[model samples]
Target: MMAERLRHDGVLVVGAGLAGLSAALAAAPAKVLLLTEAPLNHGCSSAWAQGGVAAALSADDAPELHAEDTVAAGAGLVDPEAARLLAAEGPAAVRRLAALGAPFDQRADGGFAQSLEAAHSKARVARVKGDQAGRAIMEAVTVAALAAPHIQVKTGAKLVGLLQDATGRIRGVLARIDGQPVEIAAKAVILAAGGIGGLYAVTTTPAELKGEGLGLAAMAGAVIADPEFVQFHPTAIDIGRDPAPLATEALRGEGAKLLDGAGRPFMANYHPAAELAPRDVVARAIHAERAVRGGAFLDAREAVGAHFPEEFPAVFAACMGGGIDPRVQPIPVAPACHYHMGGIATDMDGRTSLPGLYAAGECASTGVHGANRLASNSLLEAAVFGERAGRAARDERPASGPYAVVTAPELPDEALQTLRQAMSREAGVVRDAEGLGRLMLLIGDLEARHGRAASLAAARLVAACALNRRESRGGHFRADFPEAAAPDRTFVTLDRIDPAGLRYAAE
Candidate 1:
């Protein structure tokens, strides 16, 4: 079919999660057009986030302390300035969400109730009814976006390609609205799409997210950062589900234990902090224990117990529906791909290498999350950087010139499934040069047979970068080289992905 052309005289935002909504709302006085592949409150990883937003909300907590925790958890690759910026603006972001009608659990003294998770020194994660943080916050933001006068949201509009002029400046996007091809021209394009968890067979994110935004940006000559750093959640409830349900980390924060299949606690053997160690440590521990012991489980029977429903209703429902009761039994758990610590390279204000283009949220690597993300910082990054991307994009003038859409071929369902399984086996948690090389071969075979789909581009980036990085650091662990190297970040464009010549490009 011939493509339909439409011109949007404002900023175009992709994905409708926290970041996209925040960007649209922040682009006040400048009209905004937001496009999402899924309906509001679904598909996007934001609403399914069980952990709350991380912020220094209490009197004893400060942004500097929060920044310290973030930098420490990142394993030395975090941009100190970006981490400080996120930490400094976190409290205001949480308050902004609350002002939009999100009913966060508050203390008796009218303060934000906080929980301590993983690496944080303070109980600074602001939540709602224990584990409803993402849903509650997204609901409020969705309502506000719907009511806003300057924002126009179009659901079920899937991004297929990016539109760029002859000078290689991004002008707009090529999307499919209900299977009909439509070309949208805008002043600036802000990519707020989520992560690449769906690329793995076992994951905690919605299956619809396959790093298309990241791939499209790279295809349009934007730089990618740390494509090999994928974070796996340690407590994904393994109930034979495709996209496994997540058991909130707060359960461990509340004193839950990680036990082997024999019901013996095993985390103490992995790290001194045990259940509260950094997420990568815990995930690797679980992966190791599962290999030898048949399984690893989270025992919340004594921690939350009778308060399971009230404390974590989502976990309780998922367990009950899967024939496991958290009140008395341990929930079977495994390391599942949860977040991408890498994406389109962006500055603190969300500007990418290409002019007239910006990126935010999980899709953009603003250096707050270096090799591994600190727990609960995902939502904070979305709100803080998403707004910055919005304001920055609002200042762009419309590009003059005929635009061309660089579209990618689509991968069939069978090929996608094959790729997912391969990714889980080789690149999911622990990786090595041998396995990464095998994965690269498979990616090349699939691309040659199925054409270069966006999914293929995303997977190729991860495999290529993982193969090039020999040393283990944070989320990008290599079993062959299991020690830390000098701190460095990886920056590559499509043209620079020569694996034999690739190095960790330090900025």
Candidate 2:
């Protein structure tokens, strides 16, 4: 086990997507060791994002407007301060990404081209091509990071657990490289490891990212916030793909409508905004439609017509592979798990409650998203908070002391699969008290069997939280109790999981 004692300088960033790359770049002049479970360009949800980044880049738009839209979309739980920070810094983040060579679509006037997404009052999302914003932005950031002298990238290294010192402060990470565990000690660690979408049998995230980051942080006793709120994208191409390909919201933005099997537009009956409603509303509408009308579809023929392939090559290719033509007919769509709003709780500066551990990207709950995330705000959140965390980590120096690596117990394959299925069925798009209670019982059984596995730890947090929240709100919909109650954010920790009541300190 000679590989067990390697050390690194600066920060150890787990996951090498936009957030990790952005963090590495922002911590420039200081050395950074970036690790990825897959190759540089693969296994990241950032590449799968098609809706582009939300920012107020137009003269007619303002950050205050953007903040208001975000709060409205979040269904009354969005932190006002976090929303304000995201709104204020959005333009600068988009501009910086553009400066790194992101080929964002531009208007004839040379300003950034913007489009409307669901729930936004104005057309403010900056895009590339049509749905290529994620890939384009990632490509640009990867180029900059690869060229940066201070960044050292290690591909195919999967983070297994966090390494904490005697006092429970994080010191480094334990990673598995080529089937061997290696310990790398650093001053600070940033967990940017996406979300729990992959935990489901069907998702929009890469299959490999099965909530390892969230599980690892929870096992290390980190404060996990809003673990029950998982966002399901309302329009994933229902082509029988295991990890379903996405149909961009931009198609709907361009006037495409959601229809049923008989070719009838159906969203108008669900919400006044129809196709332009926030994701939670749209996802529920689609789910209800499918439950009643067999399935839902996106009709893009008149909206983009022959321009579909050139404008949105990814969606076009996916449609072609399924023997469907977006130019002629509607693309079949269904609601699928796409993002998670709950994760390691962090401040605006991306510092977690634990001293030496920080988080960014989808894995950090800065309270900006609350119960539901606004469209295209995820990429903006990653960029803005990634930079903040990087700068803060770079300014600090590690104390001089000997540190020991702490390893959590490993989970078996069967136990992991059981946990995933439980969470997917119970705490999924729609839930109820009976289902959540069954899920909590299953979690306890799995934890007892697996002896405190990280996967069980994460599953318990989600199940417990979902069981506590009695009313439907945002991404968390209850079929039995299907109404919004007094608006408030729900927070939970491991100690709060009880048979009597779910209790955590009131924020």
Candidate 3:
């Protein structure tokens, strides 16, 4: 039977986040189709970001400094070339966003109003209003994308698998649009579908992003790199919300202190950088604080004070919604799963292990964020690599071909809840051999029950890799192996998840 395929002549971008949208926009005049699980301006982490993009745009700062900071923050295993690419081309990406009408905050002197974030060497994070950079930038980009003539947006399309031609080259995806399975064949497939934040019980990302792109690519035989390194944001507002709201790290950069339940400042006791410490440090600190009787909190009253609404609208609204006043009450905070530093391995030009398969943004581990990611670099990476992927795919349109449809396993609600609980309990902020082994057991059980669900597939990759690595480094902290060993990075394919090997060689 002929595949029920939807064929597009140009590039097919699987996702509508910063990377996907940016790719579509960059692949101008080429017929670009963006397949998203959500509508134009919703369900993407990019829209929820508050700290804004990091670039060496300030006159006093340099890209070399930014690159140094990125390497320092990545713990070990950060690719020098990726950091160089991000640092060198980041300013241009931000400039292009500005030209596209992004409402970035500007100084009185008319330059970008950049702010300091944790682990960054300088105040290089550009903002919008105060904490509205992500939403504002995405809104502007969405407007531009909608106006673009060559781009087509397909909302409500969920990708399940990748398609391959007879020669085993990448072509497109198998997606379910409006609940109907359909094959999509294109010249090149760009997987910008974000990360695995939604797989955790508590996260700062939309629940829809359950590692779909990463899982799909892995299932299609792409080289998955560093799947064990997951970054937990230190200050997710602990308001008992499903997708916890974030207290922008810029608040800490502006002097907000991390406190405990007894209204005592605590970050200074943990790290010299205190609240401005690296994200992993802060997250572990918060987790340790919570482990103690004193629960973690982010006290930004002194930082934003009466200007909370203007300086951080999203946080102000979330606090108000949760019946907390940021001016008086120290917002309850905890380490929530915020970002994934590991994903489908790709190159500087966004080429994955498979030909015609490319990835950018959170889904692609371009070796930029090795074990831990620098604050505000995620958005910069999306812009820099997304454009590269777009330009690469623009003229590489392949011959139209057939595709295969592989549907996701039908996971019951209870099984998903079990998976979430297991992920949080075992793979949350810290890890150990026992916990990882238990996690693998649960993943195996879930796989047996659900028959290869994409979420479980991705979750298993993380657990299996985390189980194999025996040293603490970057975002991956093993309580059993608290010492950092020789620096290394993990590279795994689909068949190796039962037991993935770690490599110490440079890529």
The candidate maximizing TM-score is 1
RMSD vs true structure, all candidates? 1.7, 2.1, 2.4
lDDT of each: 0.92, 0.86, 0.88
- Supply candidate 3's per-residue lDDT for 187: 88
Worst 10 residues of 3 by lDDT: 498-507
Best by lDDT: 1
Quote the positional error of residue 222 for candidate 3 in Å.
Answer: 0.5
Q: Per-residue alpha-carbon lDDT of model 1 for 155-189, expressed as tens digits?
A: 98999989999898999999999999999999999
- Estimate the TM-score of every prediction: 0.98, 0.95, 0.96
- Which candidate model has the greater TM-score, 1 or 2? 1
lDDT of 2 by residue, 1-507 (tens): 655877676887898878888888998888899999899979998987888999999999999999999998998889999999999999999999999999999999999999999999999999999999999999999999999999999997988778787787888898988789898888889888888876776688887777778878876778888888889999999998878999989889999999998999988998999999889999999988898889899999999999987899999999999888999989999888899999999999888877889999998899999888999999999899988888878876775467665555667777767766777677787898888888877767766676766656666777778777778999999998898898777655565567332333344
What ordering of candidates by TM-score runs from best to worst?
A: 1, 3, 2
Better of 2 and 3 by lDDT: 3
Of 1 and 3, the candidate ahead on lDDT is 1
Winner of 1 and 2 under lDDT:
1
The residue pairs that clash in candidate 1, if any, are none
